[model samples]
Target chain A: MTTTAPARPAAGRSRRPSGRRAARWPAWRAFLLLTLPMVAGLFVFKYVAIGWGFLLSFNDARGTIALGDWNGLDNYRRLLGDPAFTRSLVTILLFTLFIVPVTFALSLGLAVLVNRLRRGRALFRTTFFIPAAVSYVVGALVWKMSLFSGTPSGVANSLAYLLGHDDAIGWVAAVDPPLYWIVLVTVRLWLQTGFYMILFLAGIQQIPAQLYEAARVDGAESEGRLFRHITWPMLRNTSVAVVLLLIINAFQAFDEFYNILASNLSGLGRADGRTPLIYLFQTALGEQNYGAGSAGAFVVTMLIVVFTLLQGRFAGFGRTAEEEG
Target chain B: MRRRHLGSYVAVIVFAVPFLLPFYLLIRNALMSKRELGSLDWHWWPETISFQGFADAFGNDAVPLAHALWNSALIATISAPLSTLLASMAGYALARIPVAASKPVFFFIIATMMVPGAATFIPTFVVVGSLGGVNTLWGLIVPGLFSAFAVLLFRGFYLRFPRELEDAGRVDGLGHLGLYGRLALPNSGALFASLGILSFIEHWNAFLWPLVIGQDPEFWTVQVALSTNLNQQAVNLPALFAGALVAILPLVALFLIAQRWIVRGVLLTGIKG
Candidate 1:
């Protein structure tokens, strides 16, 4: 799964192009023809942007993206110094820390449960996966407007009323309990848990049934025992990959947070829910502070890469690459 | 080995509710009148189904729901095929071509994936803005199509492609492009379908890039327009729900129709970074 790319083709392949003029020229031409468009576009759009943004981060490009005003680490220093930016960083860090483990457990549990069902498996899978197809903006709209709306008539509020808590809580507004986390977390769970569940289900399905049968025969009568020994261990790769993706995604969370907590034109509505991307968004686009924005983007990217590398090291995520290579 | 577990059934039903809740509320409120939406009455259903919400949503001048949907469709249609072609070609080349630089190229593309898009977004925006791509459909479509993830997937698919087929195609006088177009591309329907669906759904649901690129109302994708509508002062609640319904239903329908390929595409995520 990690390294299927071959360094060279097989012996009899004409594409190897034995010292023939026409064959070699056409082969090179085809390689360029095939890969040039996408590689060039990526080089320009991604690599060039990264280079320009790196240079831009050091300069005071406020209200301007032009590069001559070299400030030399001022942008990075200012961002780290500003409470809002630092707070956003802390906020995203906390989000990634919390959301990754919770989502992992829930999705894994859902996958196990769903996989056990002989009846209505597709029905359950479709129901769970449907939200994955939904746009975050729409999901946030529904969650914000109907489910978590501050009004007493809202579903959550109404449910609370039935439970004898008569107060119509402002789920997205209350900072005392930081109830906005509830809206943000629940919406993400609803929207994303199912997708991860699918990945786990695929992983679970890949384990041979004979292993479970053999386990059942070897005094592993209980489902929990079977899962602990066979299912969990067999799912090591999937679990690690899922955890890695969850961390990256948790760090990159902007859409639902922006949609539910932000009042787009007014910017991020509260300090409580501001993630790094939203902060960078407001900085770069809203304030036209491209310098700070570029700097923050670099910081966030470094954070993600650091976490990924850490996971790769401790979790042995890229171990398969070595084997296959 | 297939056992009937009551707990699994119970848990699935319980878990399915939270996932289904938002969709239910979205549709329910989208049908209800503004009065019914605000009512304190504990009615399980809207008093009466109404298209007025949809009417008001599509009717809203500032957000322009109908036009936005059209723009999104156009962007998705163009971006999907274009990305699939380019990504599939690049991916296949990285997989099959014995070019000396292929391994370096693959690492470069994958490295691009490691950096979050937002980090490089401002400069990307600057490039496009300088190229006069802002407020144009191409502004959103062109830049967004160059996904390294997509290239990675195609490369993975082609790595497993049998050498015998290409060997046979060589005997037929087909060059590499000719072989890809005629021999490889035609047979890999599953990959094409999966990649095509992946690209389309991505373009349709994309928010940040579309928002940054399509500043004018004329170019607003559905997500951008819905976002603008939600943030507007004095938002019409029912109309917003209606707009959301209009926005998500196409994808929902598409998902149900193409669940097989979409899930296959998603499962491909486990292949690698």
Candidate 2:
């Protein structure tokens, strides 16, 4: 909390000749001391490991990271040829398409509403944002075991009963109706929408109050027109960044899918619901087919980059904040 | 004017209900007794508010919450601060310190931002495995030591950092290292705490890595422990819910204490990225 500057020491230290030597400690040496560990660790953990994964993908090595036997395009070919992997890739694509827009709209809408509040902005923000603190595992457990549980005693079923639907619907297990998506989508919406809402709130706050006054003077009679001409256009960068992060997040969707659909009471039967990360998890870890798994890694990473680049191009992501204002 | 406020309040209520319902159910079910869990009638208040679920969970040996809590604390508390300190130093060096390789080094660190950890997680695990890091605390700690994101945040902060402070440090005959140790690090208390606390929560909540690597029960984090509870035979439904609530207790407390700072931190991560 303290923002004060460091106190000036007495003149005795500077007056000594030895103190001059300490001050003259080379910038190069300081650079080495500061960055060496971070750089080296990054090199080893991220770059080297990712590089090794690329290399490992080419090899016929099964159940081991040791090298020598090279399989070339076989791993890539295998993953692409397999319906499961392709389905995972497709699932993530559809998920991104489904989730990004819905979440984007929801968060922006929530931000606009919450920002409208004069009395309880913090209260509402905290109520929404509190879910963001919950882990997916815990969230999934609550969603599956309590709220969306198939039994008649569950929350959803109780609501349905009150609405005249006598039979309890198995929300997660019904593949024909694809009710699992509701469970998956709602839990994700609950957990993530709040964080993005906060971001949109920040972006909304940066729009000067005078802009609204100016628009009112210009005879902008309705909220819709004000939002369109002022708020929506002003939130371009924040929206782009939010979409980019959401796309990345959606692609990396394993935790909820696993806990909700895969782990607890059931095995993963629906290939359509399995995300790329879940597919990769099974390929590498479950089946111990690390090569195909490694191959899938590059594929997923490329999708994230391509989707982000495409969205960035559309949204004009590189504009300066001052230019946006 | 009154209508507008009321309309927004109603809209807020509409959003808040869906958001708040799960938490309410989680708490209610956690306190419900085992027999009550199976009751056909919906009990808004459990007939007998029972601690049986909690007792079953804590008293169960298969999924050990106590050990997992210790492991999670050790991993988060240690790695988060270490990562924050390193990020600050690297950030300071990039922004403030004059070095020939600053631009290239900064670019190199920035390049890694595009690659999500979820992508190369297995590969990273394989590397950690090769280095004998599997199932050990070192495995969890080492891979996450240097955060490029945190470093980027620090570099931004330091770029906008007032030059007079560094100049004053120089006037005091402080070396570059001394200036960093004394002036730069000390001045960044909020940044350190904000980033560190966020990272701490992430580490604590981390499931995938811990689940994959922690094959041995002794190495379980609370998440893995909770997941492990699912597959265990004769599932204690009430106990499972209780365990879920317990797992979130520390996080809930941390969040309540530092919610304002957390939002600011989230705002930074959102807009900056």
Candidate 3:
């Protein structure tokens, strides 16, 4: 393969003086150089800092920014006993349960319908995907100001009135009784469903058409046969990946909640909505409690790790080398 | 058969309303003058449309949006191609090299996807601040510029590419660099474009990190400025909508330009491992 092989010396011998190993040296050096910045950034920003944050949760308020003296599990004890933390956990869980299925089903439905379209599929795809291109900040603003506005001038309330509801609802400000979470759920679905629909569409296209043709010819009904034999089984793997991702993403839901509902309680969701990440943010940046934020972060990191492991166990995420083979 | 098609159209229209209504309202409101905007009956179109809102948008002091646009464009241009190249190199190694640590490295990179950005916020802020990147474009670009997820996508595609091509390049006296740049690169344009657009959209719409890091109003991205402007006491819905429309226009344009790849990226679980 080498054009310059053995002119003065063999290529490997020429590359190394007295030959300890030339190829390995350059490859490792090049690889290290390419990865240095990312590794350093992740090490400092991601893992080590987070480990420090974890350590802070056990300590009392120390020198303003630095770690304080250790209180030995008192923070964990407090978090366990706090009813607000419990409510936050329950609220987020309920939000996930409602959001995941509705979104998955709607997105899957869109994918199947659009995929079935022999004409103008591109138009439908473009129309459906515009929301994804919309900024989360903008989308959340629209939801807050117009769509779910509690006044008659608000779009959602107008529509509700047309639909026979007597009252204009303060959808975003419904925190004390907890309807604000529903607004949070609706805003997320608006922003994300298009993105996931594209995923489901991808999964559907990979499915062979012959199975459906055979089913039709063999006299199976359209809806029943498609649901029972074809669509259900074919989309299994994609469904798992999507569901696990949604669950993790739901816990990470912040921007929409922050942008839209942040003001509803005077920015207290940084305290209340308190998805572990939000809690971490409030503690770290909002309250300037970097140590506790880091502590809260590590706890969330542990939760993310456990969930990912469970997802890998069940969904076979990131297929193993054996599976690849 | 006609009935079935009709039913399909009905279903699509009905289903698509929830998706389209918000955008429709945004556009409609953006066109209305502030006086007309208060009307309770919001429909698909306004009887009288004006650019007063857009004019007002131009008049506001919510961070020189033109400069932010330029910053976003420059960052997207630099970061997308650079990240693609970086991801491609690492992906090539992961895909082609049989080093003992290759799989382990891949897994480790993928595992960081689970690391919530919030956890890294303060530390990254401190690091960026120490590097004198705070209030600079570099602050925004540094953290997000290289994505592990993009590497996974590139690796997935590269692994599927026939190795014979690389072997042929090697046989022709090409170094690993030449083989990567010349042989592997041209063929992977769609994947690269897809990843580039995805990364650009993310950076373009990046809010929290940029909000924290870009403390200088001079460096604020459009998304950050829009959020700040809209949060003011006298919330001007019309001008706000206009700004929102302007802010999202680039993304919509990019998506349209790369519609095919965007669809491909989406349908292929272009995101997942």
Give the number of the best model, judged by lDDT.
2
Error (Å) of candidate 1 at residue A96 is 1.4
* All candidates: TM-score: 0.95, 0.94, 0.87
Report per-prediction Cα RMSD to one decimal. 2.5, 4.9, 5.4
* Stronger candidate by lDDT (1 vs 3): 1
lDDT over C-alpha atoms for residue B97 of model 2? 69
* Candidate 1 global TM-score: 0.95
Off by over 4 Å in 1: A1-6, A9-18, A263-268, A317-325, B1-4
Better of 1 and 2 by lDDT: 2
Question: Is 1 or 3 the stronger prediction by TM-score?
Answer: 1
> Which docking class does model 2 fall in?
medium
* lDDT scores in order: 0.84, 0.85, 0.71
- Two-way DockQ contest, 1 vs 3, winner: 1
Tell me, per candidate, how large a share of the native contacts it keeps: 0.69, 0.69, 0.39
Give a tens-digit lDDT track for model 1, residues B1-273.
423577678778998887888888888888898888888756678878888888999888888889999999999999888888898899888887776667778887887887777656777886787678989877888898888888888887888899899989989988888889998888878988887987898889998888888989999999998888887768788899988888888889999999999999888865364
DockQ of 3: 0.38
Looking at model 1, residue A214 earns an lDDT score of 91
Name every residue pair that clashes in candidate 1.
none
